[model samples]
Target: MPVVFFAEGSAAMGPEARAVVARAAERARAWPGVPVVVRGLAATDGSAGFGRALSEARARNVADALVAAGVSPDRIRVQPRGPVPYEAMQVESRRVEIAIGG
Candidate 1:
């Protein structure tokens, strides 16, 4: 199992999105291939209900894809949202965390 943090490269996420992804990936290294946490970000009106749902769905899709790609369901996690820098993310998307013990 390998942990991979994924985020969209949308312009709305700003230039810092890559940096955020890198930091998340670094954090993920702690568990190697065991516990995987994925985070996705998108730009929307930040007020539409449908948009939020779509974002969450995208995140879940990524996580599920990872599983299909070879990761165990028990070792997969996902977190999705439209986040702001430095502030606590509202989790407008979703969060999934899994750890497969060695």
Candidate 2:
């Protein structure tokens, strides 16, 4: 899985995130027939509704970034897993995971 980390409370992509996306794009280009899944995740700090909305927006932002990185929008799918509290550090939860599959 290629993962992009976001800054605290923001959906803006940083250098690290862009690098991850670039790598994912490269992998997508290498295997053009594969489907890329971009999973957006959010921290569990806020209300459920707020977290869901934020996660969805963050997911879309990641998908947009992937498109900007030259991956066809049609080849990417966005899945927002809202407010998963698995990460001990809240900041670590703010991320988008890109996985290539059939």
Candidate 3:
């Protein structure tokens, strides 16, 4: 079964988002053979911080980074999250279901 990791964090905008995307892609690419997807979400109340997140503009940043690191994009999906936990708290974490192998 493919593994999909949901990585959530408080990214305000700019390099922060790019950095997170890079990290997620690195982790995803680490899983050999088994397809891996790293979904990154950033939550903010629309401010300068909003500029710090890639979750708003592009989701494939993670996937693109993964491909650059040698992972196949065909096996990955990067999704944007409009609302996510840990925007204010920055420490909150959650896990949900992921149905793989459709």
Candidate 4:
């Protein structure tokens, strides 16, 4: 699983995150028939509804990037795991993890 982090309150991915997604897309291309699971996560913000929406947006954005990178949309699954209970010190929970395997 490769994690791509995003700034708090935003669903956008930076260049480095996009690179990770690109690599994941390549791996998905290499192994046909395997499913790609993209889990979107968010920090413990004040509002649960906002957090859920943000996380979902993050997942869809990453999924779109994967498709743009040539991965088939049929093999991709987006799961938004709402905000975490707590944020780790300097680490925020705003991220989407790309999990690809058999």
Reference-based lDDT, each prediction: 0.45, 0.81, 0.44, 0.86
Q: 1 or 4: which has the higher TM-score?
A: 4
Candidate of highest lDDT: 4
Most TM-score-accurate candidate: 4
lDDT of 2 by residue, 1-102 (tens): 888888766778888888888888888888888898988888866687776777778889888987887888999898988776635658767888888883
1 against 3, candidate with superior lDDT: 1
Q: Which residue pairs collide in model 3, if any?
A: 12-52, 13-51, 13-52, 13-53, 14-52
Candidate 4 lDDT (Cα, 0 to 1): 0.86
Q: Candidate 3 lDDT, tens digit per residue, 1-102?
A: 222233444232255445555565555556555655444444444544552354533345445555776666677654555445445534222221111221
In the predicted model 1, the residue pairs found to clash are: 1-33, 2-33, 77-96, 78-96
Off by over 4 Å in 4: 87-92
- TM-score against truth, every candidate: 0.45, 0.88, 0.45, 0.91
> Against the hidden true structure, what lDDT does model 1 obtain?
0.45
Residue 84 displacement in candidate 4 (angstroms): 1.6
Clashing pairs in 2: none
RMSD to the hidden true structure, all candidates: 7.6, 1.8, 7.1, 1.7
lDDT of 1 by residue, 1-102 (tens): 222232432223223433443444444445456576555554444554544554566556655555554455676565655443313343422232222333
